[model samples]
Every structure is written in structure tokens, then in C-alpha cells.
Target: MNFKEKIFSILSNKEFDNLTWNIFHDQIKNNITYKNYLQFLEINPFEIKNISEIPFLPISFFKTHRIFSSRTTDDYDIIFTSSGTTGIKSKHYVKNLNIYIDSIRNSFEFFYGPIEKFKFLGFIPTNRKDSSLIYMIKYLIQQTHKNGSHFIPYHNYKDIFSNQNDKNIFIFGLSFFLLDFIEKNNHLQQNMQKNESKNKVIIMETGGMKGKRKEIIREELHDILKKFFCVKEIHSEYGMTELLSQAYAKKNGKFQCPPWMKVYIRDPEDPFIHINNNKIGGIDIIDLSNYLSCPFISTEDLGKKINDNEFEVLGRMDFSDIRGCNLMTPHFLEC
Candidate 1:
């Protein structure tokens, strides 16, 4: 079966590991950037048997290098760019749009049922055009086929929540914009109360304050969001421009990845040694769906694994470019 089919059908850890190995082999053979990275480390791809032994390409390389694990370079369907609000932006060249859409849909469905059952309302500011989050939200809104599902501009909080006919409402917005929405609209509780008895409202933050506000801890931010939105838990989407797959946190700021995606924590001082579970360290991800680019990516975020299947993103690495989704916390330095 093709990777698109195999990725969604992953049922066991063994199957996922086996597929990751295959993807890694392909990446080493076809992707020049990854091959060079591995070569620079003085590691032979053939000697690596386990998934843990495979060296993940640093996510910053996406900004500095053209990472494509494909035979040709001209078949890019879409290029997803990062917010870059802090510094240089990272760009992910998606060879097939269908793969990305499939990953988005499957991952979303894995966490929160099907997209058709919810009305998606995006509150992302249109400061940049090539945003992967905006594209994903737009696609989800289209899939819902709901009447009031649309993108709302910044500072223009329209009365879109008035006539929701029993469908769950999902408001996907950036961290700053969502905060701005609640701070400016004091009557949000009253507006939300009208539908509270009938429809479920889910406010999901896609991280990043974008220099619009001071950076705060995720727990504090979630607490503010939960109280203002009248929701018990504030949902979060953990993703970046460099990744095709996304992890979702339903509650308490604990994120769970889909079957094809796995998260690992590595020691910050020593990038090669992966720390034990519940240890706060740098975040490393293995996204099998990132087959076109690089599947394994060592990110700049600091996180701790709750268990084998779940993790928590505490903040970014020290001095790293502040980006979307993951919050920034100085507590990581104490680790």
C-alpha cells in the first residue's frame, strides 16, 4: 500500500516503527539534505536498525536547507510557511496536497470525531498568506459544509454564534487573537450562554502570541481562556510549518499524537541521548506522514512525556525563535 494508506491504518507500535524505518531508509537514499546530515554525523544509514537509532534532522534546517525526500524537486503542490514573527521563517514544501489534507483530516478525526459534525470558525489574522494553519482551518471549514463556518477577521467579532442548529462549534484561533477576542468582548459569556445549553463550544488555541502580548505559561493562558470562553478545557493544536502531521491536546495541556506520529524527549545538552518519560527535555518528533520531506525532526520545543502515547509541550528551547503553538517558558533552563 502507498504511504497515505499505510499511515492511517497504523494499529500497533511495531507497525509504526516498521514504517518509520522504511521512510528513514527512503529519506537517506533520496533526500540530499538528510543524507548529508547523517553523513556529517559520521553515521551509516545501513547500520541503523531501530527507530531510536535514526538521527532526526534539526527543524531549523528547514529554514536553512531545502529538505525534500523526493526524486524530483519541481512537483511541489504547496509550500507552507511559518509565521516568522520573530525571525526567519521555515518553509515546508509539500509534494502532494492530498497527503497533507489526509494527515490533517485523519489526525483531527482521531482526536475529535469527524470534521463534518462540527462547525469550524477560524479567527486567524490574515497578516501572512502562506500559513499552514490557515490552510488547514479553511479546509476543515469547507469539509463541515455548515452555513456559519467561516474565518473571522481580527477585532471584528461578528454574531456568528447566534443560530447554531445543534452542531458543535470549534473556534480555531492564534493565542494572541483568541486572547484579544476575550479581552475585548466582555459579553462573550452571555453570548456563549445562549448556546451553552444546546451546542458544545470548543475554543482551540494554535499557540504563539506573535509579539502581540507578553508570553505566559500555558497553564495560566489556558486558565484565562477556560474562564473567559466558559469552557472547561482549552484545546490546543501542536504543529509547525515544518511538519505535515499535528498533535492535539483535548484537556489539561497534555498532547496526544496520532498513530503515525510519535514524540520523544531528548536531553538539551546532549541531543543524541533521549531522556526517560516525564523528564523535561527538548522535543523530538517522528512523523511518518512527513515522507516527502524529512520524517524525523528534532524541534526546538521543550516537553515531557506523560506516557508512551502522550506528551506535554512546556515551552521553547532557550534563545530559539519564538514561533506558534508551543509556549515560551524560562522553566526549561532549570531542567
Candidate 2:
């Protein structure tokens, strides 16, 4: 079977390991940029056997170079760009759009049951035209193909939550936009308190509070949102332009990855050292679904692994450019 077939077929941990090794080898051979990156590091691809030994290309490389694993330049189907407000944006040249579609659908279903069970309502500010987050949201909403499942303007916050459907309402918005909505609609708190439909609402923030308001900690942010939205817990999506798969945080800012994706905490000063347990460090991602592009990426975000199945995104590392769709760096997590 092809890499695409084998990747999605991953079930067991052993199977994931085998496929990752296969993809790593394939990328070193076929992906010119990755091959040169390993060569410059004086690392022999043949000597690498275990997953930890493999070198993760820095995510910044995506901005400076075209990170793709194809023999020719014309092989990509679409490019997914970052939603950064300043500086150069990272672009991911996707070879197979189907892989991304499947990744979004499968990842969502893995976390929240079936897509058909929820009516997706979102307010995605169009800062960038080729936004990966927008594409994911649009694709999922379209898949439901229901009458009430669609994007709403910022002024229509009441209309967004007014859907009285039986299906669970999955409301999506950028971190800043969600905050803006609630602040302006303080009446929503009083109104929603009386409405029985508030129980069906699920508010999911897509990060990015930069430049919009004072950056606050996740705990405080969730507290405000919970009070305003009248929900038990606030949901958050952990994703980027460079990655095909996403991890979801259902409650208390703790994120859980799907079977095909994994997160590792690496030492902030020393990139090679992978920290264990709750020690805060830079995040190294092994997104097996990012096969076409670079699967192994060393992101600038700081985080800690809670356990084998869970992790927490603390914030971004210092000196990194402030980008959109990124959470606030709490003063405490900075320590």
C-alpha cells in the first residue's frame, strides 16, 4: 500500500511506529530539503532506527523554504497559509487535499463522536485568504450540510446561539473575537441564563488574542468564557498551518491528541533533550498525518506532557514573533 493508505490505517502503537519509520526514510530520500537538512546535521539517515533519534526540522524552515516531499514542484494540490498578523507567514504545500480532509474529519470524530451529531457555528475573521483553520471549519460545516450550520458575522452573536436545534451546537471563533463578542453582549449572560438552549452550546476558541486585548492566562480566559457562554467547560483547538492534524482541549486547557499524533516536551535551551513528565519545555510534534509535508516538526511553542495521552500548551517561547491563533503566554508559565 502507498504511504497515504498505510498512514490512515494506523491502529496500534507498533503500527504507528513502523509507518513513521517508513515515512521518515521516504522523506529523507524523496524530500530534497529534508535530505539536505539531515546531511547538514552530519546525521546518517540509515543509522536512525528509533523515533527519538530522528531530527525534527525547525518549524521556522517552513517560512524560509517550501517544505514538501515530492519529486517535482508542481505536485501540490493546495497551500495552507498561517494567520499571522505580522512578519512572514508559513505556507504548507499539501500534495493531497484528501489527506487533510480525512485528518480533520477523523480527528474531530475521534474527540467528539460524529460530525453529523453537531451543528457547527463559527465566526472566523478573514485576515488571510488562504487560512488552514478557515478551510478546516468550512469543510466540517459543509460536510454536515445542514441548514443552520454556517459562519456568522460578528454583529450576529444572538443569531449564532439562537439555533434551537436538538443537535449539539459547536461554536467556533478566534480567541479575540470570542472575547469581543462576550464583552459587547454582556446581556448574553443574563439572557442565556434564562434560556434552556444554552445547555446545548459548546464554545471552542481557536487561539489568537494577540494585539486585540490584554493577554490573559488560560484559566482566567476560560473562567470568563464559561460565565458568559453558560457552559460547563470551554473547548480549545490546538493546530497550526504547518500541521495536518489537530489536538483538542475539552476542559481546563489540557489537550488530547488523536492516535496518529503525539506531543513531546523538549528542553528549551537544548533542543535535542526530550523532557519527561510535567517539566515545561519546547514542544516537538510527531504528526504522522503530516506525511506529505514534514511529519516531525520542532515548534516554538512551550508545553508540558501531562501523561501518555494528554499535554498542556503553556505558551510560546521568548524571542519568537507573536503570531495569530496562539494563546497568551501567562506570566506564571514563563517561569
Candidate 3:
């Protein structure tokens, strides 16, 4: 099967474990990092029958190395980097933009519905360009072809509120931007209550304060959103630049992975050891959609498995050792 067909079949099939193992073996054989990691662990890939036996590459590797499982490249179609106040940004070199686009489109439709059905409104508080989130939003808007689907700049409430109609509306915003928008448009709360429009409005927050505002707990954030939007639940998008796949949270901060993705909680003390369900540990992800890049990644986020298909992101580890620092040279640091 071709790449797209294989991924689609894996997602649609009920026997995910077998499908995942097959993909894992393929990755191990093709990916240099995976091969090296397996060698370092002194574990033969052929001996790894269970998915838990697979070792995940530390997420920091993206910062220091060019991470691609398949092709070596002198050029990349697009490069996505992590957002941060300080420290080296993790760069994801996308060889084929189509793969990333396919992953984003399929994952969203998997969780929510067709892209054309919703009027997407994206709000990014800052002016930073080349954001994967921004790119995804722009793609969604273009695909939707709805009159109201577009990116709103400077919290243009007048334009947004004026355009609100019976169509299903989805507002994608960064946490701080959403907070700012809601605070500035507090007067709309009562108006929203009275309008009684047939449109099912969903406020999906792409989590991150981005050092722009004081960090608040998810509960408080959701409460404010619920109060302002008059919606029963708030949705969230959980993703990073390192991986192609995304997990979504409809409500209550519980995120469910897409069929092609899986989350495993690993013991922070021993990164190789996978922990049981409901136990707080480091988050390790297997994103089969990331076949071009490394499929397995060990993230710095602290989280626990809610079930086989669901997980909750608690927070990041406070004192985790920085991984890619060794590769930084004095001249690079001076710059």
C-alpha cells in the first residue's frame, strides 16, 4: 500500500495494535535515529513484539539534528519551529508539505467533522509568522470557502459579531488572545444569550499563555470562556511542532488522540519504562502520520493516561535536563 492508503487503513481498522506494530517496525528499519536508539538500548527491533518496547527519541533532538526518517534533503518544503521565550527552538523540517496538510485535515475531520461545514475564525494575538497553527488555520479557512471563514486581526469584534449568522462557527485562538478578546467584548455575553442563533458556536483554544499573560488553570480558563461565549463546553487543540498529528479536547481538558496516534505515559525517572494507566508520568507519543519524520517522541510534558484512547496533559516537567545543548557551539551561543 502507498503511504496515504496505509495510514487511512490503519486509522479505519479496529486492530490498531497490529497495524501500529507493523508501522513501528518499518520506522525502526528506515529511521536512523530509531535504529541508533534501538542499538543504544541493546534491544533488537525484531524482538520488540509489544509497542511499549519501542524507545522514543527525546523531543530535543529536533533542535540539534535534522530529523527525517525517510529521505535526506538539501531542501525542505517548509520548516516549523517551536514557540518559546528563551532556549533553542525545536525545528521540524517538513520534506513534503502535503503530508503535514493531509495529517492536519484528516485529524480534524476525524475528531470534529467536515471542514466545509464550519465557519473558521482564527485569532493570533501576536504578529509572529511561520506558525504551524497559523498555517493550519489558513488552510482550514481556504478549504471551508464560507464567507465568514477568515483570520481576524486586532480583535475586530465589530466585524466578527456583525458576520455571526446561522452557520456553524468555530473560533480558533491562542489562550491569551481568547482571554483578551472575551474581556474586551464582555458586552456581547448578553447579546449572545438573546440571539438564540441556530449556529453551534465552538471556541477552540490552542493552549499557551506565550508569556503574554498570567498563566491560569484550565478550569478557570474554561469557566471564563463558558461565561463569555455562553457555550456549555470549550474545546482545545493539543499539538507541537515536532509531530504531524494532533489530539483534540472537546471538554473537561480530556484529550482524545486520533486513530493514527497513540499516547503512552512513561516513568520520568526511567524514560524507557512505560507506566500504567492513570499514573502521572512523562508523555510519549506515537504519531503514525509522522512517518516522514520520527514517529516516536518523548515529550517533556507531564501527563497521565485517561484510558487506552484518551489522555490529559498536566503540565511540563520543571527540572528536566536540556538535551540538545551539547550540540551548541561557542560561536553559535555568542550569536
Candidate 4:
């Protein structure tokens, strides 16, 4: 089967190890970074039997090298840069934007039903044209085709709440913006209670306060959002620019990846060893949809495996490189 077909097939199947192994072999053969790393370790890619044996490229490599698996070229359709607090940024060169589109669309639909059913409202503060998160939200909003599906500037609470309809509304925003919106529009709680509509309201928080305000625990953040939004629970999105596929959290902070993606926790002290499930360790992600780019990425974030398919982001490692998505200057853009 071809790459896309294999990805589709794996998305529906429970047997992931065999499929993962096949993709790993193919990736090691085609991906220069992976191949070179294996060569450096004197380990033949073909001889590797298990998915766990496959070496993951350090996430930091993206900051230095132009990481890609197929077709070495500077030409790219779109380049997504990591939101680093520092001036330096990690660049992900996307050969085909369609692959990213498929990954986002398919994964989102798998987790949240259909894209056309909900109205997407983005509350991102940055105006960076190259942000992957912004690009994803924009694409989803376009697909929704709903009247109110658009980016909600910090001051524009009236525009979103002014309209009264039964249309399902999904507000995707950074943590800080959502909080700011709640604090500013304290009357929204009463408005939501008055609108006795059957519409499903979802407030999906993409993690990070962006260094705009002091950081708070996820529980406190979600509690405040739940009280203000009059929603049962707060949802979240777990993703990074380095990865094409995303994991979603319906409630709490536990994230579940799409079938094509899997997370493995490796010992922080010993990178080669895989830790037991539910044990906190370094996050190593294998995204089969990242065929053009490197598939195996060792992220600096610390997390623990919930099962074979689920995990939770604990926090970032100490003294790790600051990611662009997590920290944003408050004055530059409103919630």
C-alpha cells in the first residue's frame, strides 16, 4: 500500500505495532536524519524489530537543521515556525500542505464529530502569518462556513455573544485569552443561562498562557472557564508545530492521539529505554502522517502514558528551549 493508504488503514485498525514497524522501516530508509542517526549508532534500520527500537530525532534538531524525510530542497509550500520565547525558532518545512490539511481535518473529525457542524472561533493573540496553530484554526473555520466562524479579537466579545442561535459554537483560544475574555465579560454567564438553546458550546483551550500573565494550574484555569462559560467541562488541544498530527483532550488535560499517531515515554536519563505505562518520562511521538518530514520526534515536554493510545502533558523539562506557542507577550495582541 502507498503512504496515504497505509495511514488510512492504520487509523481504523487496532493492530498498530506491525503497521508502526512498517512505517518506521520506510521512514528510516527515506528520512536522512533518522538514517544518519542510526548510522551514527552503528545500528542498521532494517535489523530493528520493534517500534520502540527505532531512534527518535531530538526535537532540538528542528531549531538547527531543516528536517525532512523525502526530497531535499529549500522549496516548500508553507513553513511553520515554533513559537519560541527566545528569538530563535524551529522551522518545519511542509512539502505538501495537503498532508497537513488531511492530518488536521481527519484527526479533528475523529475526535469532534464533523467540522461543518460547529462554528469555529479563534482567540489567538499573535499576528504571525507563519503560525501553524493559526493556520489550522483558519482552515477549520473556513470549512465550517458558519456565519460567526472567525477570529475573535480580545475586545470583540459583543460580536460573538451578540448573535443568538442554536448553532454549535467552538471557541478555540490560548489559555490566557480565554481567561481574559471571561474576566472582561463577566455577564456572559447570565447571557449563556438566558439563551436556553440546544446548541452545544465547546471551549477548547490550547495550552499555554504565552507569558502574558502568571501561570496557573490546569484545574484552576478550567474551573474558572467552566464557571464563566456555563459549560460542563473545558476541552483542550495538544499539538506543536513540529508535528503534523494532533492529540485532543475532551475534558481534563488527558490527550488522546489519532490512530495514525502514537506516544511513547522514554526514560529521561536513558533515552534508549522505554518506561512503563503511566510512568512520567520524556515524550517521544511517532506521527505516521509526517511522511514528508521526520516521523519520530523526541519532544522536550514531559508526559506519562495513560494507556497504549493516551497520555498527559505534565510540563516542560527544566532549562529547555522556550516554545513559541506557550509564551506570548500580552501587549502585542489581545486575547
Tens digits of per-residue lDDT for model 4 on 98-144?
88998989999988888887888898875898889999998998887
**lDDT (C-alpha, whole model) for all candidates:** 0.82, 0.80, 0.78, 0.79
* Candidate 2 runs further than 4 Å off: 196-198, 319-335
- Compared with the true structure, what per-residue lDDT tens digits does model 2 show for residues 196-255? 454477889888685777788988888988888788899999999999999999998899
Per residue, candidate 3 scores C-alpha lDDT tens digits across 13-44 of: 35567667777777776767656656755778
lDDT of 3 at 107: 90
Error of 3 at 116 (Å): 0.9
The TM-score of candidate 2 is 0.91
Indicate the worst ten consecutive residues by lDDT in candidate 1. Answer: 326-335
What's the C-alpha lDDT at position 188 in model 4?
Answer: 65
For model 3, the superposed segments whose C-alpha errors exceed 4 Å read: 11-15, 320-335
Candidate 1 deviant stretches above 4 angstroms: 319-335
Error of 1 at 156 (Å): 3.1
Give the Cα-based TM-score of candidate 3 against the true structure.
Answer: 0.90
